[model samples]
Target chain A: MSVLLTPDQTAFLQGTLSMNVGAVGRDGWPCVCRAQGLVVARDRRSLTVLLSASRGRAVLESLDAGSAITLVASRPATHATLQLKAARAARVGVSAAHHAASARCVAAFGAELETLGYAAGLSATLAGVLPTDDLVALRFAPDIVFDQTPGPDAGRVLAHT
Target chain B: MNISLESLRPCLDGAIPAVVATASPDGTPNVAYASQVHYVDSEHVALSFQFFSKTRENVLAHPYAQVQVIEPKSFRHFRLKVHYLRTETSGPLFEYMKAQLAGIAARSGMAKVFALRGADVYRVLDIENVDPRLLPAPAPPDALLKLRRTFAHLGACDDLTRLADRALAALAHGFGIRHALLALLDETGGALYTLASLGYSASGVGAEVALGEGLIGVAAREAIPVRINYHTGDYTYHAALYVADPASPRIPLPVLADPHSQIAVPLTHGEYLVGVLYAESEENAFFSHADEDALVVYGRHLAALIVQLAALPDDAEPALAAPAPAPSGAPLAVRYFAHDHSVFVDNDYLIKGVAGSILWTLLNEHAASGRRDFCNRELRRDPRLPLPDFGDNLETRLILLARRLAERCPQIALEKTGRGRFRLELARPLQLNAG
Candidate 1:
């Protein structure tokens, strides 16, 4: 079943997945690279990450091998981090929910998003104008989600999701 | 010069005013004016006059006497007292009295008449009881207030080295010492390191002394101030480290050369002796009782500062928790980087080395917390020979090291990353294992 996330959940997923995605590396070793972009599925049950193939291929290979991995996603200013543990499934295409999540990230980070080439590259990739081979999507189905949020309201939002 | 009555009457046929005071059996004090008294020594006063004086009778009965000689114009007072032993009408005192009377008569233009009469002198013998109230009231609160200010100043200081220097300077200035040095106790409290010094050549500092070695050591061991006359034969345990010129003929070289006064005050935090403050002067009586009191006050404040400084935790080191175990069924890769020579174990150990071992030893010895940056800097500047590489061959070496570590510690998951970094992920949170 595809789960539709509310705006708060969408924001939460973007933050958590962003942190966790950076932790993933080839052969369980973190490599020197940056987070490209985070795209959440319309149902919010899945998140699509666009990263450098060169930098991310090793981590994807580790995930494909069924190695248990932990991704730490967090919002920098707020001490909110989500540790999502799961093996990677097959590659999937960007969905409407993914584009909406991307737009929200762009709006939240604004000019800062350009520094990571996330907003520009993600937009190009989704328009069908950019080549898809340049990007590889790992559909993360969270097995265990650990949410560290500051207050009761944030905890409820994470718990409900 | 207001001479006592006994001296005045014998010298000039002039009577001098004197006041005799005595404490009665019931503790009540009695004072009487006497027209006859004389100076026996700088410390003693004698009276020779008619026995009808109440003070004379009091002194005769009680045998305890206090006499004051007052220079009415200058307001200067000389006080003395003696307990009576016996009375004598003739002796050198009598001859001295005769000379004084003739002089008095000559000064008064009655020399012929006074010379014909001769001089009468009565000597009081034995001095059993004499009370001299030379010390003023002890202003304990005033001393305490100065001590409090000193402590507050020291407490506001954040730097240990600077604080120690300031304290030594204050001590030296307050006590008027020609030279002062403060030596901090080493880890075992068996030795001392000179932390600060004043009024000495550069060669006179950075000296170390063992326990029971010098005045400093004695003060530390006894936990009290040690006052010595360096020139006296009594103090032979002077530390060579403190001597500016050992071959010089004088031992303490006499304060500046006076060799008569020296003091070593132990800086203590509670029962622990942190260091000693040594002060010396060239004068025989440089350190009066007042100076000793001042030093004690200063020493107490210094001790408090040393204690407070010792209590402050070192924040330079990074807090390194033990490596956590990797998740279940995860492949472990470990790598050793030779450039930095740091061991990067899988997600677990960030950095470890012989430098770390040395730092650990120092921290433990000093009872200090290990700081990451400080440890790193120490390693970078380490004067000792470099440690051997973890393995001859990086790849095979790491694999063996990992298997060995795994066998010894079953809980920790050690994995080798293809990159220089290794991951040691925890199967469970680190806090659970803490129990």
Candidate 2:
């Protein structure tokens, strides 16, 4: 059975700083980056990320060339991670996913980082210092998920229900 | 101005009830009166009639049908030469037709007409063509008019990256190009540096072309738009130009492989050619004179944006200063994208997930009504069920979801507006830096 994340778990997975996304290139090399504003599908079975075409296009092209991809997201600071091995399902318009991810991100961190300086920093890093027209939304269907949290109790938490 | 169904009803007032006409296997004309002539969405109309009609039977046999709807009194007509695909009998469309039939019956004092609903079917209408004379006369050039009125709006954009993106968006949206590239001329106007490109790889951006090198360079050097046909052209100078791969099978290199169309519009401010907006398509003669005119207009607007950005003080904030908040209680414009799982505030603050949808619908309703508040009166009411809420745990879950989104995107604010209403607002418009 697939590991189902509760609302709290989902939130933790999203806000956790250590969750990394690994993508495989056509040459079989894996490129790993921090998963920004990763969102779970409404059905709780899929996760999506808004990837700039500049960076994510390579992975998409690789997938189009029939290369399988694995995305591992983890909160290293808390020693909690959700690693999902999946293939690219589709690429949609950035506007479609950005709005959702932005809203969720705002709600998730809006109160804690209300300062203008923080907003500027967030915008600079997350929205990119420059805007490109081909920024796209990548939807991935996870074939397998691996979760690891620290401590003896972490094992139970990572255990499939 | 708000366009309502009432206003649209007048357009169809004189339109005749369409008749589906098809040829039988024996070449006999089979015709059936179609009552399914109603607005589908805001722009298109849907027509539904009985599937078992002679015309439907003939259409199934032939896959081709001509539908005619004439002005009731004038006999002036509209015809649609359509190829029938399939029939959808259930779902939202069926319910929509049911409600429409009910309204029609009520208005015509024939409520019994809806009683035979199942037998009275609906046919999907696809408009193939419209009589040219039926269309209204060409409107005056509103581009220049809008530019005059909204020059300040363009002037307000302070970021070069955004200006570039917007310029390309205008080109793609207006000209229907699969991809676009904006390469700014270096300070000396000698070489072109790819500042940003749509539908091309990252490696393509920042690439350079010397003055008088390729199409873009020629356009920049001459300060004129360069139109090229790649298939038969002497590509000795255009071999290294970057072309978007996903758009077509043709490669950007080896420009002489197959016949392709390309247009390069130099971005100019008065006399200075600041950049080149290049667009291409694999098909022959992809662009027209009218398209070139639009691109020139767009190029002018983009030049204006660049000049304004260049004129801004170096120390000034990168985004437009917020015009004082619209009173504390002013409603905000919001758009909800449930299928895509996102919400936009004033079409700017794009937030992800169901929380965005909730906030979007609430704010949109309140804004449209000039009201200050709304509640969860219709939660998860969409039949498509794109959102998943765990019943009473909605608030808590949403709060968590909001926090997750905030971690990456901190500019958006979701706050309680009143007792039951929530407002999602952008702290500032997104700023895109060119460097």
Candidate 3:
């Protein structure tokens, strides 16, 4: 069975949400890195998120072909969280489309933080957005998704791809 | 592994929440936001396990997790590799985190949503700074030097009143803490009364807070330190319990309109809780873990000194003051209520409980005879006043009575003449009544 993200979930992933990527290394140790932006594919089953090359070096080193990967997208002010897990992932070079999407996402994230009472330029700096040349994208097809909101229904599965 | 958790203490302030990464036994990775990455020690940390999420499940299965914390001031990030130890459902650390989370929840208007279930203790396996570009952190004030000076000042005090004043003064001068108060617990009344304070327009010396009412009360009741780094109305003592009525005898607790940081540390002598020491700031996150530690040590020192000074033997003979002629004025009405032993001066609410009872007794003794001096032995043996048998804080009560009189009814005073004796000083004639 193939799990597809609902329209609302896809919109949420592509919206001005803070993203973080998690990957497990060969030693079974997991690493985390902040994501600048993400772009959902048309199929709604796969997505690619831009990670800063220097900041996300730990997670990038942990990434391997067919290794497990997880990305959590959260709306900061609301604490609305969604987690997507895939059994496989691959690190790829930044594309022109990824670069443009990264800029748009970072700007939108900064605006969202501004509305949440963060000082100007502080929100953007906290997001850790980097030049597109220093960003790497990880593409994966999420097979498991969880509504990770901070309440009783947090771990409930929304879909299983 | 090259990094130490001590240097990364700022990152655990919860000013910026941490993101936790965990991997299941089956190799599936999980990531989520942990609201608090509590720094337990140099090799340990704790996370609030409020919800049964994927991260919790993965940790239970695999035991290994990675946490990334950001220092709000510098925007610097650090990654900590930790191994899951055991979850503590109740303890000092759990209470500390629960108190902190309550403030966070209240600020976000999610008080009902977030509840701390357990403190998941973790052993730090390694720590690494993810960012190479770092801002130079400002050198913190010398906490050890401050504590040393504070103790030195407290060591010179010989009485509870002097001890309380010196303690507050030490906090102001040494720790740079401007807003602070020292309150002693009235065990029989299940309340705490403010004896001394600093940095407020009003001294609020006689203000009382019921047990479990606010940070100070809760700290005394639970015998644990309670600290909130942000302003939260949910725990505001004045709003929580104090409702001043014109007819009632009450002193409103001193409050900051909008305090961003507040902490209350329980002052205990061994197992007995003696009182609470509290401090606040208008600036957010002003009190850190090190400050809390210093305050705890300072509170214990102050409590021990108070007990030691209170136990000193009295002078061999009671020194009596020569009866001075009373001033020519209208008789001041002194009313005492038996229900709560509350005293009112000229129909104005003055004080209540043991202090009030002591005042009533002193006034009666003065009216019956021209006696001006009293001894602790007579008060301790007095059957009319309610005092504990084992650890009767009579000396402290006299001190409280003296301070309350100084604040409310300046015409009446209680002056310590010796270790166990005190003289009742009056500037005007008094008419005593029992209501």
Each prediction's Cα lDDT score?
Answer: 0.43, 0.46, 0.81
Expressed as tens digits, the lDDT of each residue in B185-264 for candidate 3 is 77564777788888988888777777766677778878887778776655443222542233557887676767778899
Off by over 4 Å in 1: A1-161, B1-155, B229-237, B241-258, B316-435
Cα lDDT for residue A27, model 1? 29
lDDT string for model 2 (A86-107, tens) is 5454665566557666445533
Q: Which regions of candidate 3 are displaced past 4 Å? A: A1-7, A103-133, B107-109, B145-155, B187-190, B210-213, B236-250, B270-272
The TM-score that candidate 2 achieves is 0.27
What TM-score against the true chain A does chain A of each candidate get?
A: 0.55, 0.63, 0.90
Q: Per-residue lDDT for B290-328 in model 2, tens only?
A: 455567777777876766654443332222332335444
| Highest TM-score scorer | 3
**Residues B52-118, model 1: lDDT tens digits:** 3333445555666544443311212334434565555654443333333333333223334332122
Off by over 4 Å in 2: A1-161, B1-156, B237-259, B316-435
For residues A25-127, what per-residue lDDT tens digits would candidate 1 score against the true structure?
2322221112345766667677666543543454456555554444444553443555444444556765555455544543444333334322344333223
- DockQ for each of the predicted structures, in order? 0.00, 0.01, 0.66
TM-score for each prediction?
Answer: 0.31, 0.27, 0.89
